[model samples]
Target: MNAQREKLRMMLTSAIFAAIIGILAQVTIPLPLVPITGQTLAVGLAATILGSKYGALSALLYMLLGAVGVPVFSGMSGGMGIIVGPTGGFIVSFIISAFVIGWYIEATKATVTHAFIANVIGMFINLFMGTAWLKVAASLSWPEAFAAGFLPFLIGGVIKALLSAWLGIEIRKRLASARLLPYSSSKRTA
Candidate 1:
């Protein structure tokens, strides 16, 4: 019964985080390749707080919502067409980012510094995916894609990483204080 309840709680948390990601998409800075959105922060936070499984699930749900015409995507665009569009790679990268960040957090026992590093790793994944997709879908050369798709977001990514790391630390502290997470023996010893 307790396990079932815990599972339900995790699911609810995941959905909430997914909704937050959607909300973040509404906050955007227009650019050439892909608009800057708060979605990255939400993605980082989701992974850092929920760990890989649930984190990926949340991002998947967010993508599904957009694919199904929920207007949860950036600029309020949605539907399956967007998933196959030029910027689709970055959109798809959200899942990968969540998985990478969450996995790193779990592997490193969720230290703040490690979480920041993990976020940077995740950002790189986003850049790679986004730029590659831009190259293929938009028929741009590597340099052009990199210039248009990745360059504009560099500083913003760093800022997001720092902010998300702080957010992750705060979330971890709250979850620990609330006794909401399963205690790790390794973490206890550390």
Candidate 2:
């Protein structure tokens, strides 16, 4: 009974995080090729708080929602069109980023420092994948892709990573202490 309850709780939490990612995705700053959004920050938070399995589940849920014309993507857009569009790589990278970030946290301590390091790695993953996709989808050269899809977001990525790290760790700590969330090791089992 207890195990079933825990599983349910985890699933519920992941769903909540997926909704959060959608909400944050709307907070966008438009650029020529790709816009900066809070979606990555929410991904970091989900990974740091939920660990790998649930974190990845949350990202997958978010992507599935957006893919199905749920208007859960940036600027309230969705559908398969966005999935095949130029920015699709970044969206796809979210699943990978959440998994990797959570895996790192699970392998190490869920401290702010570790979370920040993981988030930085995830940020790079997002940028690299997004840039490559933009190049192919937009039919641009490497320089153009980097200029439009990568360079403009570096500073913002760092800032979002820092924020996610600090906030995620803090929230995780509190939730764990309250028994609302499991701490580091328990998350592995959960």
Q: For candidate 1, lDDT tens digit of each residue in 93-164? A: 999999999888778766778889999999999999999999999999999999988999889998998888
- Model 2 spans with C-alpha error above 4 angstroms: 183-190
Question: Which candidate leads the pack in lDDT?
Answer: 2
Error of 1 at 163 (Å): 0.8
In candidate 2, the residue pairs with backbone N, CA or C atoms under 3 Å apart (3 or more residues apart, or in different chains) clash, namely: none
**In candidate 2, how many clashes are counted?**
0
Per-candidate TM equals: 0.94, 0.95
